[model samples]
Target: MKNLKGKVALVTGATRGIGKGIAIGLGEAGATVYITGRTLEPSDENISGTLLETQQAVIDAGGVCIPVQVDHSDDEQVRLLFERIETEQKGQLDILVNNVFSGVKEIGNAFGQPFWKHDPSLWDAINNVGLRSHYIASVYAARLMNKRQQGLICTISSWGGLSYIFGAAYGVGKAACDRLASDMAVELKPDNITSVSLWPGIVGTEEMFRFSEKWKTEDEKEPQNSTMRDYYNWETPLFTGRVIAALADQQNTMNLTGKVQIIAELAQRYNIVDENGNRPVSLRSLRFIVPSAIPALKKYPWLIPDLKIPWFVLQWTMLQSPKI
Candidate 1:
C-alpha cells in the first residue's frame, strides 16, 4: 500500500464490523483516521465494539486514531462532526467511508420473515441510520473534498442490492446506497473526486459468525441451513478495507468512479487474501455455471424476447410478494 502518512479519513460506524476494519486499514496505511460511532467507551454495551477499542486497534497498527461519538442518524451531530474535522484538520479530508447501518437487529434470526410482518419502524430504522445517514455524511464530505479537489467516498454496500438477500428494507437501502454513489460520482467527477459502491461478498464479521453458529444449531434440519453451513468462503471485513485502501492509493481512481465493484473479483486483481490466507469465492462465480453466460446471451436478438417474459414476471412477482 502506498503511504498515506498525511491523509485524513473519516469512517462512520467504526465501532465494529466492516467500518472498524476499514478504519484500521486506512490507519495501517498511515492515515489519520477519525473513527465515529455511538459507543464511546470500552464498557459501552449498546454494541459489540466501542469506538475507543477501534481507535486503540488502529493506534496499535501504527496509525493515528481520533474516536468521536456521534449518532449518525442525527443530522446536526453529523454536521458538527464535519465542522470539527474541518477546524482540526485544516479543511483537508481525503477519504470518507459511509458504513453505518442498522435495522438488521430487528430482523434477528428471522431471515425470511414476511416484510409486512415486520414492525413498520423497521423501515425507519434502516433508512434513518443506513441510507439517510450516508447521504448526510456525503453532503459534508463532498464539501471538504471539493476544497482539495480530490477524495474517495466509498459506501459499503452488498450484492443484496442486486439480488434479494435478506428482506425488503435491507435490500432497498443497499440499492439506494449504490445509486447514491453512482449519482454522487457524476457530480464529483468535475472536481476529480471519486465515489463508489463496494460489494463485499459474505463477510465473516463477528456478528455474522454468531449468526452462523446459531443457524447451525437451530436450523440444521432445513435445506437452507446446509447452504448456510457451506458458506465457509466468507471474506473478512478487512478484505474489503484493504481493497478500499488500495483503491485510494491508485493514481487513476477517477476511472473507477460511478462503478459498483465486487470485492472478490477485485481481490483477485489486487492479490488480496483474507486474514486466514484464503480467497473468498465471488457469488457470480459460485451461483452461475458461466458467470458471463447471461451477458453473452444479450448479443442474440432471438434470445431477448424469450428472456424478457420470465424476467419481467419474476420482477413483478418480487415487487408484489412480501419479501421475508
Candidate 2:
C-alpha cells in the first residue's frame, strides 16, 4: 500500500474483469473510487459481474466505492459521468483509468483470420469504444486535473502494441493507445498531470480465460504455430490495478509519464503480489514465460532468476512477428 486516503478515482468499465479489479485495488489503497459500467445489477445474460457487485468488492477492499451506469458509446452519457463526478467530489478528480473495450466478442469471432477477411466495420467495433473512448474520458479528466494542475491518467494497454498478439484491429487499437498516452503526456506534463500507457502481462481475468480458449482452439488447428496462448503464469487483474494505484501515488509521477509501463516490472518495483501471494510472470523473464508456454518445462522455471529483455531488443518485433 501506497497512501491515497483522500484521492478520488474514476475507473470506467468496472463491471467486471480488469476495470472491476482496478477499482477494488484503488479502493484497497484507500481512495474514494467511482466505478462506471452498463450493468448495474445481475442480468439474465451469461456474462458475470455488475456495478453493484464491484461496488461491494471495492468497499470490502477498504475504500469507498460509488457505482454509476453509463453507456460509453454515447458522448452525452460520458459527459454526464464527469459532470456528476465533479459535482460529487467537489471539482476534485485525482485519477482516471480508461478500461472500457467492447471488442472482445468481435475479436473472438475474427480470431486467426487475416485482415482482408475482416469487415471494415471491425475497426469501429474495436476502436470506437476503446481507442476513441479513452481520449474522450481523458478530455474530461484532464479538465478537472488541469484546474488543480495535477492528476494521473492511465490507459491499460498491452504488449500487443509492440508485437502481434490478437489481430489487425486489436493490434492497431493498442498501438494507438500507446501513442495516445505518449502524446497526451507531452501536453499534460506542464500542468503537473501524469499520463502513460500500461502493458499488463497476460492477465488472468475471467474474460481472458475465455479469450485464451480461442487461441487454444486455433493453436490446435496449427500444431506448428510458434505462438503461445497459455495463462498459467499470468498476473491477476487486481495486480495490474494495484500497479496503477501505485502509479497514482508516486511522489514524482512525471518521471514515468509519456511511455508504456509494464505492469509486471511495476509489480516488482512496488513489491506487489496477488492476493494469493504469488508474483505474476513477465514476458521478458525467460524463466516464467518459457515454462508457462511449454508446460513440459514448468518445473525448471524457478531455477532462472528474474531478468528482462533490453528495450532495444523487445522493440524489434516486425521481423519476429508472424507475417499473417
Candidate 3:
C-alpha cells in the first residue's frame, strides 16, 4: 500500500467525482497528495463535495493531504499553486492529474443541439479550463520535473475525442487534450518527463449519476437507454486513480510516454479492479461489454470470445488508410 510513499502528486478540480477518487487512490498508495478546487468548504451546491472533504478522504485513505482553493481559470492562481508545491515538496512533483473542467454543465444542457445553434462561448467554457488549463499546468509541472529529470503528467480525456460525444466543443477539446499530451511528451522525453493522456470509460462520478436520471424512467425500448443506468457497469471514480498510481509506481513508465492509455487496459496490466472488485469493461471489448451491459447475457459469459477493437483499428478510416 505504501508503494508511492515518497511520491508527491497534485490532483486539480478534485472537490468531487473523479478528482476525489484520484486523490483517494493516490492516498491509499501512500502518496503525499495536494488537491485543488474552486470550492473549499462543504456547500449545499448541487454538484456537492469540497476541497476540505477531499482532504479528509485522502487522510482517511492513509495519505498526506494538502487542500488549496484555486480557480484554474486564473493562470496566476495556477502559477502560485505550482510555486507552492515546489516550495513545500522541495521541487519534487511526481505526478500531475489534470482533472479540471468547467463545461460539463454546458455540454449537458446542449447535448442534442448542433454546433451552429450553440453559443460561441461554449468553446471557451469547455476548452478554457479543460484543454488550456491542462496545458498550463503541464508547463509548470515539466519545469519542476525537469529539474529532477522525472515526472508524470496525466490528462483526463474521453472517448468522445475520437468519434464524437457531447458536442463539437467537448470533442474538439478532448482531441486537443490527447494531442497536447503526446506533443508535450515528445518534447519532455529528453527531460525524462512522461506525459500521457488517460481515457476512463463511463466513469461513475457524481455528475454522471446526476446525468443518469433521465434513463431511470425511460421506455424499455428507448435507444441506448440501458447503457448507463445511474452508472451501471461503469468504473468508479477511484478506478482510474488506482491505474494512475500504478503508472507512477512502475519502473517502465517511460515506455508508455506520449501514448494514450486506456484505464481499463491499464487496470488489467496492473491487475486492478474497481471498488466493487469487478474488472471494468473496456469500451472496445465486445466479450466483456455484452455480459456486463445486459442482465440476460450474464448467464453465458463465455459465449462471446474475448475481442477488442484496438485503438488503431477503431480510428483507422478510409482517409487514414493508404489509398490503393
Candidate with maximal lDDT: 3
Q: TM-score of the candidate numbered 1?
A: 0.85
Error of 2 at 131 (Å): 0.4
Q: Total clashes, candidate 1?
A: 2
lDDT by candidate, in order shown: 0.79, 0.85, 0.85
Q: Mind sharing the TM-score for model 3?
A: 0.92
Residue 300 error, candidate 2, Å:
2.6
The Cα error of candidate 3 at residue 225, in Å, is 1.8
Residue-wise lDDT of candidate 3 within 91-135, one digit each (tens)?
A: 999999999988888877886679889789989998998899999
- 170-283, model 2: which lDDT tens digit per residue? 998999999999999999999999999998887777877787665666545342132335445667789988888888878887889999898888888988888788887677
Leading candidate by TM-score: 2
Candidate 1 wrong stretches, greater than 4 Å = 44-46, 217-224, 287-324
Model 2 spans with C-alpha error above 4 angstroms: 220-230, 292-294
Per-model TM-score versus the true fold: 0.85, 0.93, 0.92
**Candidate 3, residue 59: CA error in Å?**
1.1
At residue 110, give the lDDT of candidate 1. 47
lDDT string, candidate 1, 207-240, tens digits: 7876676667754555434435655446788887
